[model samples]
Target chain A: MLPHLQLGAEIEVGPGDDAAVVRLPSPRLVVTTDTLVEGHDFLGHATTARWIGRKAAVQNLADVAAMGAAPLALVVAISAPADTPAAVFEELTIGLTARAEADGASIVGGDLGRAGQLTITVTAMGSLPLDQEPVRRSGALPGDVVAIGAPRLGRSAAGLALVLGERALVRAGEDGRPTIMLRSIQDSSAADLLRWHDAPDPDLSLGWTVGRSARAMMDLSDGLVRDGRRLAAASHVTLDLDRAALAPDVEQLTGLAAELGADPWSWVLHGGEEHAMLACFAPGAVPDGFRPVGQVLAPTAHGPEVLLDGAPIEGAGFDHFG
Target chain B: MLPHLQLGAEIEVGPGDDAAVVRLPSPRLVVTTDTLVEGHDFLGHATTARWIGRKAAVQNLADVAAMGAAPLALVVAISAPADTPAAVFEELTIGLTARAEADGASIVGGDLGRAGQLTITVTAMGSLPLDQEPVRRSGALPGDVVAIGAPRLGRSAAGLALVLGERALVRAGEDGRPTIMLRSIQDSSAADLLRWHDAPDPDLSLGWTVGRSARAMMDLSDGLVRDGRRLAAASHVTLDLDRAALAPDVEQLTGLAAELGADPWSWVLHGGEEHAMLACFAPGAVPDGFRPVGQVLAPTAHGPEVLLDGAPIEGAGFDHFG
Candidate 1:
């Protein structure tokens, strides 16, 4: 038995923790897995192995931390076609090692094989040493404060648009001059949007600081409103957003509105993969490292709703298949 | 820490008992990953969810197992196109669970993505626990006794053929069908061939048994003879064989030989994925759970060194992408 097994309740031995350890009530081991497909999740040609590995490791690790679980070990499996150069595999190991080490977790085991295209799968396991039940999205009460994490939004999608010029905005802008918005995160800066687009450095610190004290919490991988609605539905409450407080990501969306000619608030409301944490807290429950965003109210006729300054926010966030 | 990090004379923080804290002496983790490429590794349409997962798990598990170290844990990344249904993923979980349950190791993490096909990537971690020195094929002694584990060969290939009507041999055999083979195992009367092929029950059994005692050991995933020559080349020795021990699965080959006059030893010496242990034991040494067969000797001037009953045994094993 591993010496950590002696750590006991923090880590339970349930048939060897193969796929997952089914947990009930207290001390639930946090787990979440995600798979990135070649054409759907990434570009088949442009994505590098190291970035894929890093992005793969970080996202799952973030999920566990988002639940306020102390990071433990990681399991990864990657699939790529046989013709892929061996160097890609080497790069992947480096990416996995770098991120895992930073998170104080190690890549324990993994699987690799030939595939129609590259696919990376990551599962993260975390130990929650809490006596109270984990703060799921279902815990928010009728009256609560809603908060959001510092989000670097639209960076990735913008970078993707630059790479895939097939976007209508890019094509429309191509006729004359460059769009100021695109030029900001352009290739010249050390803060190139492409790098973040390729590998989004998750703000795990925010999860660590605020997770446990919150009444209900969720990682915002999807756009704000979509994920906000999910939390509201989970807790059977209404979350009302202050469009006035919607920050710069929203203001900048005006440039995007000129291109797509849609409401900047729509993109602010619906752009996906922000990976921010949206949580609900009881009155006076404040945690460090969190930014207050909205409020939760009694259930409404709209049914477990989310509002943008007393009105419904339309448009859902991005979806892989949808 | 994994609770097992050994850095030469120094010990890094343990990686935790559930995982081996390995610092590969080679710098490189001698990795070779395989994806049970949906249609290629298994039936594109077969429902071996548990078996498919077992198949995918064992195939890669065997790869690391062949390296002669205890397989620590596996990272399982899977790709199934959308509309592939959740049940396939569920069954895969069963297979992964079955294999990972042992060794007190957990599946740390994984990736899932939409794909044009069903694909599985399993990357395995192995510890060259023998200091930085791993037991490789290149270290066999000339006077070593060549031996393998208990298995009736060609059962896995036969099972595949039975299920898919691909291999010529299965169509003619009554007892070798999947229905029969599965029934045998269910009845606790598993045919040695099926047992060796399907689940492969390969573990640290041989790694622990032969780590210190044997001169060389390898899992016989690729037919014994082909891999035997590899051991010979690595050890710079000559390998001689006896025809008698190769008679089990080749019994039917005799009648076919009498009809077409081809030797039965051809199949026994060259079929792959048997997963039996093939180790070279020093003279007068008997590694537990192994039987002695051919003996390793000083290199011979004869162009072909492998001989059966003093006559050359003619064949090689299966090749992947060969």
Candidate 2:
């Protein structure tokens, strides 16, 4: 029933068996899992099945990238209402396969079942390069520099604000692309921000480059401040950011923030779902395609903290339970 | 928060990072995933969170076993309501870890999220032993012996029927075990059947033995009749069973069936979730723990069929959509 589903050479035995067998590039296997639930990870009105599938695939792929591993394969388990349209399943499969193939990975196997709401759980496998070690979140040194793969942050959060705060400004187009009425906002960047939220494009290749040189690394999904705190906690260090370094990103969101009467700096620091790679590298060891955003410091009695311009930042980005 | 969770030697990097790293025993990695949803997979009143968690792990582990591989690790993704008690999560984690550890596998990593209903998705990884090849579902040939790992079947189905058919006869006890009211049937075997349905115990070691000898093998999840057809279709052969060969299994369930006014043979042939290993072996090559039940035959123009005493069996076991 699944057409255009291609299995890479690594797959020794594809689906239609008890399990799928794949040849690993190395003995070390890097694995991660993520779950996306309807009404929580996504909303029916704001996204399509294709986008949901893409988001599900990207989220786990980003985890593999964070470890500096080459993507290998993914096993997805989906549960939706029994009466869901077959077209939805087809689009979701296409989205999942397309996203995985883009990263040189394959959807080797999956399970489908009935549920009251849509849920997608993806488990992604990757392998470490022969010459490189995995960049863990615990290897950061006190003098390491904090860097980010992407130039901007908070675009997804801004896009979400546009949808939630000013619902009238966003409308689902026939092509599934959200069309902004833009009657109240004249900024062209708003459209890009909206698209970012709809579909995040994380720089996965850059993850490999950072993995080779970074002391500690992680993907920025829960905003810079929250995930930075996590990296700091894991490494037993504090991350101190230069406020001026983030000014450009904040400035980029200023126009849209004004349109919605929101703080641009808050979005830059606390907005999430960007899926950018964040790492701590030795002084002057930051790789190409990355920009320094902060520095790691020795631990203090206050435990792990993210400092903005010498002052500690308050509040976290997102907590599934909180 | 995860106490008593121990990482095996195979785990290079365990949870609390972006991903877990495990050392593979071989270049070939076997992977599978399964999802269990609330209401659809289990009922709140009839089962506990721990059973749900265990079932999720066992189903995926059985997939790994069916491939004749030693389970390496498991990655779990859970989505549940925000108001769920902390104890529920603890018990669920214990269930998952216990099941994985029983197979010498670790719960290497997991993700938790918020959803309206409970959902557990598990992805299990295993390694093909160097001395053996993967037993595919397409290698059965005419005259090969059809053998089953377990002598008994339909116990799980009988248990489910007891719960769903006569709910008033069971009540939740303080110890989490169901207390049978015993008004319908006082047979001790009926209680065993109920327990089997609640938590199936599939012998995984037998999978390794079968993998080394069987030409084609699959776990019987959807009952003998339906899955036999699948194995036959995959191998381009037909499976002709001797009714006398299945008489033992039918007799095992006869007492319970009579008490419930159900057909024993129907449950033995058509009940789902038995999770016993089914394989086609070279003539007279069945393993010690397995017993012969049928023989492979050349496919006719009508395609794959499961026959009993030379008569075609009618009806499928279970179809999620159907």
Candidate 3:
């Protein structure tokens, strides 16, 4: 059923076997796994199987990118109801194939079984250059320049808000005040935001491109504010973000935010699943396609925290329990 | 919660990161994935979370061993109900850690999310010797000796029949004749059989030990009759078995089989999930732990078939769809 998988030369043996054998140029292998479940990660009725597959692949590829490794191969495991249509699996494989190929990786093998709800788990492997070490979250230091590749953020959270309607935006506020202001305005950017939420397109090359120079890095999956706090905590430093530096990203979404009656700042700070690369680099070492968003600083006795314009911001983002 | 996870020195980074980095001594990597879903792979009411995790890990480890690779590391992705007890996750992690360690591998990383049902997907990666090539299913040739490591098969199926009771055995028959005669038997082997069915213990070292000399190798997940057909078809050969060679395995279980009024031969030939290593070696190349049960011959016009004492046998084994 998975005809779209292209067997690369590095794959000594592909699917239809007990396991697949692959050749790696480097001895260090970067590995990660993630899963998407029906009714939790997606609404099976609203989202197509193909898009679900695409989103699943993007999540793993982004995780590898966050590790400063080049994507290599992925093995997918899928469990669905027995009554599910054959076309659904075909489309899902096609989606997975397209996304893996786009990220310069291939789908080498997978297992299929029956379950009550449809779930897809993808485990991705990656490689690093012979002499370079992985850029870890614990490597950021004081005076490091905090930057982001593909600076546009929060579009996914915006898209999810749109999909869930006005109540979703209204309920997202921590305080009693409305977090977003909704209005009807015709704009294609809203559609783009929705597409980003449905199937994110991450820049997979950004990790390997900055691997040699970046001090620390991660995928911006849980919003700028929440993930920024994690990066700071991991490195035992404080991240002081410049609000003006993020104003452009907010401005780009302002058109749709106004129509949805949403606060652009809320989306910029708390939106998630954007799948963009966030990294800390030495001064004067920021690579092309990355923009400075903040600076790393020594943590006070209060512990590592995210600061906006010299004021501490409370952590808030996608929490499955919350 | 995952306190039992003993991170080996090969793991550069463990859990709590976006992904993990591990060192592979060999350039060639063998990868496989498998998933267990509640209500299908296991009944949540009947199976403990720990045994489920153990079985899930064993399935993947055996797949890696089937490829003649040494198990190195595994990444697990779990999805469960948000209301699930915290202790359940702890026990599950302990189970995964135990099985992985027993097989000389480590749990390197994982992701957790909420889902309607508890589900786990494990992706295992293994390494091969620099000078050795992987043993593939299609490598068997005419005149190869068909052998199996730890030749005690069908214990898991017997255990399953015991757990499922008499009706399950009754429904397993193909021609309406009683395949098993159910009767109460006072034997600890019955409990041992149940344990094997629940959490199989596969010989992880057998693969790499015989990898260089074995012409073909695969894990016996399905029944011997079923997997043998696959091996025969893949290699364009017929597997002509000596029933006398398999009599000992059936004899071991004959005590319980006779007590239950079940035919020992049925379990030996059609029972699955033993996770034993099945390989084809040159007549004199069979390794120390392996015992010969059959021999390979050229396929006839009717195509590759499995034979018993010079007579062709119809294919019968575990079919998920069937």
Against the unseen true structure, what C-alpha lDDT does each candidate score?
0.57, 0.82, 0.81
lDDT by residue (A99-204, candidate 3, tens digit) is 9998889999998888888899999998876687888888999999989888587788777767666322222122211233234547667656766777788786
Residue B117, candidate 1: how far off, in angstroms? 1.4
Q: Candidate 3, clashing residue pairs?
A: A180-A261, A180-A262, A181-A261, A181-A262, A182-A260, A182-A261, A183-A259, B181-B260, B181-B261, B181-B262
* lDDT per residue (tens digit) for residues B1-322 in model 3: 1456899999998887778899988878899999988777765534466777788898899889988898899999989888988767876787788899988899999888988889999999998877888888899999999998875888987777675563222221232112323346576587667667767886767987765478998888888888888889889899888899999888898888777778778888888888888899987899888899999999877899888887976647764421
Worst 10-residue lDDT window for candidate 1 chain A reads: A13-22
What C-alpha root-mean-square deviation, in Å, does candidate 3 show against the real structure? 6.8
The positional error of residue B59 in candidate 3, measured at the CA in angstroms, is 1.0
Q: What is the interface RMSD of candidate 3, in Å?
A: 1.4
Model 2: iRMSD?
A: 1.2
Q: Give the lowest summed-lDDT range of ten residues in model 3 chain A.
A: A169-178
> Candidate 1: lDDT over CA atoms?
0.57
Candidate 2 lDDT over residue span B218-319, tens digit each: 998888999999899999999998799889888888877787888888888888777778999999788888989999999867888888877888766754
Clashes in each model (backbone N, CA, C under 3 Å)?
39, 0, 10
- Which whole-number lDDT from 0 to 100 does residue A31 have in model 1? 49
Name the TM-score of chain A in model 2: 0.93
